[model samples]
Target: MTLFETFAAHVDHALDALVAAGTLPAGLDRSNVTVEPPRDAAHGDLSTNAAMVLAKAAGTNPRALAEALSAELAKIDNVTAVEIAGPGFLNLRLHATAWLDELRAIGQSGDDYGRSASGAGKVVNIEYVSANPTGPMHMGHCRGAVVGDALASLLEFSGYKVIREYYINDAGGQVDTLARSAHLRYREALGESIEIPEGLYPGDYLIPVGQRLAEHYGDRYVAAPESEWLVLFRKAAVADMMEMIKADLALLGIHHDLFSSEAELHEAGKAEAAEAELRARGLIYDGELEKPKGKEIEDWEPVTLPLFRSTQFGDDQDRPIKKSNGSWTYFGADLAYHYQKSQNVDAMVDIWGADHAGTVKRIKAAVNALTGGKVQFDIKLVQMVRLLRGGEPIKMSKRSGSFVTLADMIEEVGKDVVRFTMLTRKSDAQMDFDFAKVVEASKDNPVFYVQYAHARIQSTLRKAEGEGLGLDATQLSLLGDAEIALIREAANFPRIVESAGKASEPHRIAFYLSDLAAAFHAYWNLGNDQPDKRFILAHNPALTGARLFLAANIGQVIRNGLRLMGVEAANSM
Candidate 1:
């Protein structure tokens, strides 16, 4: 139904003719022989590397095959010209009218124009922003959160059943520290001069927790032992911080379907359940760990510890499951948590930061050991993001981290810029997020440029009202050269989105929008040189209707592209 599909089918028929003439094999696989927009527009409207890739497989010279194929393609009416370029690439220029029909298709479809069904009914879980509840989310976590959320939206649009989840690290020594910190606040609320010493949290955010404790208990636990209030204070602070974190996520338009708690797992003895499973396979045992190569402690000696045989499944060395103090190491809980995911989800993807790269092998080894290579666990690492303002880097303290929270950034630059810029690069590559650069209303900034296209079309429609255009489907099919070019660019949306969803890379959506924006801007600028090319045809009512249809098509593409990136396509700037 798409213009590309029609072009491709013609190419297939030409290839079939070549086969019938005995110039090519009768049953050659033509799936990889694609008719697509060329990287170099000067080459042609479309190009195919069919000969280059199939030459060796087919035992034929590439240029000779392309020459033979081009001769057959010259018969199609809409194909204006065919040229065999360097290394046997087939370049095609389509008749101007073909593009006009594409405009009609897009305009008639509107918002539904580029909706893809590539994912069908597949289920996928995207787990991201599993930051600890100990503090507020900094700029470091914001990029991945936005990227994951946008990617989920993109996949859903392409027809995937997606579940967005967050893992809550609410169990362990960190909560104890939080409790102690709250106790200090509690005493301070009672008018006690309690110094927030080196070991406890000193942030003013938790002062209210102390106030609430004072208001509820009224000095009941002031003289009581540490045990009574530690549990109560820890629970309250953790719950409040989690709520704050959730609110912060909401500011950026993100929500998780499930919030799996670490404390719940511990309280339910899931770690013990995992340990029992490992013990049955003889993977859990008491062992002595190797001392560090350069940093040995004063009492450095091998100590009996509960260890997991991670080396058997590809880790560098066996890893500790329990520490010398008889407490589980942080990695122990991760093993149980991941092992549980391996059982629950059909397939799993873990989004983590670059610092977690060092731990990937051991984690993978544990999954292999736990599930015996049955379930595949893919770990995607999101690299560091350096937030900049007018090209100046912002330094943030690790303790305070950043005051530029997710909410702060969204309130500043908006959700569309936040999502699109985050996906401008591969997840593993380090990215520079500049506040001054993204807000620029130029082609260099994809968000504004794309939005401008939509606004321009709406403005053109307003101008066309005086030109006697109907703004209906009957008027849309009468498109000219610039109009057709815009429609062909828009038609690429569905295909580009399907490619992005299958690749699990939302950056493709950003890239495609950039290209589409370039096409739209160029077409719109052409009106300055030619009066007829202008969207409003003052002397011709039928032609004006056709141009109005083209303008509507441009708006449709912009809306579809923005929807995929979780951005808005505004009718006006």
Candidate 2:
């Protein structure tokens, strides 16, 4: 157990003791009780809200309950003192041995130090970067991809069975445009001069698909009517584009466990099945939707369609599952897609772009109605990222086919830089990715600061090994207040992993690592003015060994954190 968890159990025992003495009522609700570090270090080592949470149920004020709880908590072996502050908060100080034991635990656990079982094997399916198959992966999809991928790793570390999924939007009209574009390129490859029309994809990335088609089919479909070859060309072009998309994602070290196709979902009648079930339950019906909100339409008309009762679940209006022409709408297909995902998982998470924020409520409502609220569902909307260079905006236009591709970004700044920089901000906040600032190699750059700390630790361990000063016979008691403070910071990794996983925010890991790195750097700088504080002392091998052991474990924590972000910790900078 972590230091926080260990003390939580102690608090539980203390509460039970209060019940045994009839000082507090039995079976009071304690779920709101929390044990965490005090906000200020001057307060104490650990803080708990047990007294304030249960005082009302026990027929006592918060202060009296805190006073009674403090006496029992004082009996813990490592608890040095318990202080009551504010209304009823209990802050407990621990002996240095508590942190020393945790430092040793870090050494013992290594890469597995921060892992937890908080998720308890619950299966969670995360769908992210489900971009349309009409173009290459761009900066538009980068943030959500990295966020979802890191979240998957974090949840897995917290013991959740996670499924990484990508939804291919191949059943839309955009794919037909891609098909026509590919046909144009196919004719170009067959020695015919062609111009890309305004509505078709114009990027040179599709040039190879046309050449391959020309080689395989050799003029068979070059002059055929649109009906004779639209499906065939759409299939081929989507297959090629998907290959390109996967390759681009690989550059950022992202790979999905499943690639679900929208076309396949329709072909298998999943949408029809979902509609039938919801209609049978009175959650869907044939109705006419109101006119578009906040807009004046010269030729607006109401038409009857099968609509899902999304308004009952907090949507602004009832959503249409199918249009009057009998084809499924995007919401209709997406609703079925989520239903298919819910069949095999206990929960589902969707990482979507902020542009799709308007549809979140309806989709959530559909999922709730389909599952009868039995399944846990969450949708995270990631805001846009503006690429910049030296504080100036770098403009891009996807329609003009001049936008920056994921491959180009990865090739320029490297995958580690791209992945780490993408997560430095909250997913919902707009961020500027300045190419110059991200690779600045200064403390202002979190990626560099964290990696530099790891590299420094590895270099120190190497020097210690060269000097034949091993960590085998070290005494942790030699670690004084300064070293113990560093240990205190390092020991929060497990708590961080659990909290970040529970909150579904992987950026918290990046923020925590930055804090830990700053602590280690401050501790490292202490050796410059004080000769005895340095890690390497030729006169005293014992002290050097203890410090080296501490440094080694801090490096281990850094490695574990960087692994979740999919960034490599540099051994030397």
Candidate 3:
């Protein structure tokens, strides 16, 4: 247990004692009570709002209850002082030995210092980078890919059985366009003049796919009509495009456990079955949708369509499942996909681009109705990324159909920089990815700052070991308040990981790592002014060993946190 958990347990014990003594009411709801660090470090090490929360239920003043609880909590181990702050807030101060014990625990736990079983082996399916199998991945899909992959890693670190998935959109009309484009390239490869008319992909990336087709068929399909070769070419083009997409994802160190194809879902009759199930549940109906507000629909006619009662699950209106031409709408296949996903996992997460914002409510409604509210589903919409170089907007590349491909960015900056920079902001917030700032070796670059801290610790450990410093006889009692403050900051890693995992936000790991690095950097700067503050002191071997122990544990934590973020902790600059 962490220091916070230990203190929380003590608080619970105090509450139990009060109830047993008839000093407080039994069966009080204490879920809202929290023991955490105070806003200002000068206030105390940890603060709790137990008294303020329970006072009204017990029919007593907050301060009166605070005093009683404080009296009971003072007897807990390692609690050196307990003071009642404003409005019955209880601030706690622990003995310095408590921090020493925590440092020892960090050393003993090693890489497992922050691992938690909060998820309890619950299977979580995270689908991301579901780009259409038509072209290369662009910068639009970059953030969602990194966010989803890192979130899966974070959940796995927190004891979740994570299934990283990618939904291949090969069943859409876009693949037909890709096939036609590839046919144009194949005709050109076979010594025929071809023009890529408007609305067809004109990127050079598909030239290889076209060459492969020409080499295999030797102009056999070149003279055939669209109906004779469209399906065969579409299948081959989608296969080659998926291979390119997989290679692009590999550039960013992402590999999904499952690649679910929409075409396969349709082929298996899952969509029809799902619709039948929903209709049996009275959720599917043939009805006319209300006119959309604030927009003009040309030739707006009331056509009866199969609809899902999405409004019953808090959506704005019922959703359409099929079109007037007897074709399944995109939402129809999506419902089947989510239903199929719900069968294998307790929870599901979809990482989508911000353009899909309007579809979130309906998709969530579909999942809820399909699983009878037994499956948990969430969608994270990643906003756009503005690529810049030295404050100037980077234009799209003509090499990939006027959109900057993720490969372009990865080629400019390495994969680690790309992945780390994308995660520095939350999913919903738009960010400017300045190439100059990302690669800058300054504190302005969070990735560099954090990695530099780890590198510095590595160099220090090498020096300490060269001086014959051993951890066997280190005296932790020699640590003072400054060292204790650093230790306390390091001890917050487990709490940060658990909280980030629960919230499904991997960006929290980035932010927490930056803070922890700042603390370590600040402490390292103190050694410059006073030689006694250094990690290595020739005159005091025991003190040096103890500080080195702290440094090693700090490095361990940096490694662990970076592992969760899918980043490597650098050993050298």
Q: Which candidate is the best by lDDT?
A: 2
lDDT of each: 0.79, 0.92, 0.90
| Model 3: colliding residue pairs | none
Per-residue CA lDDT of candidate 3, range 256-335, in tens?
Answer: 99999999999998899899989999999999988777889898889999999988877888888988898789999899
RMSD of 2: 1.2
RMSD of each: 3.5, 1.2, 1.8
lDDT for position 369 in model 3:
83
Which of candidates 1 and 3 reaches a greater lDDT? 3
> Candidate 2 on 150-259: residue-level lDDT in tens?
99999999999999999999999999999999999999999999999898888998899999999999999988999998999999999999999999999999999999
TM-scores, one per candidate: 0.87, 0.98, 0.96
Error of 2 at 215 (Å): 0.7
Clash counts per candidate, in order, are 0, 0, 0
In TM-score terms, candidate 2 sits at 0.98
**Candidate 1 vs candidate 2: which has greater TM-score?**
2
**Clashes, model 3:** 0
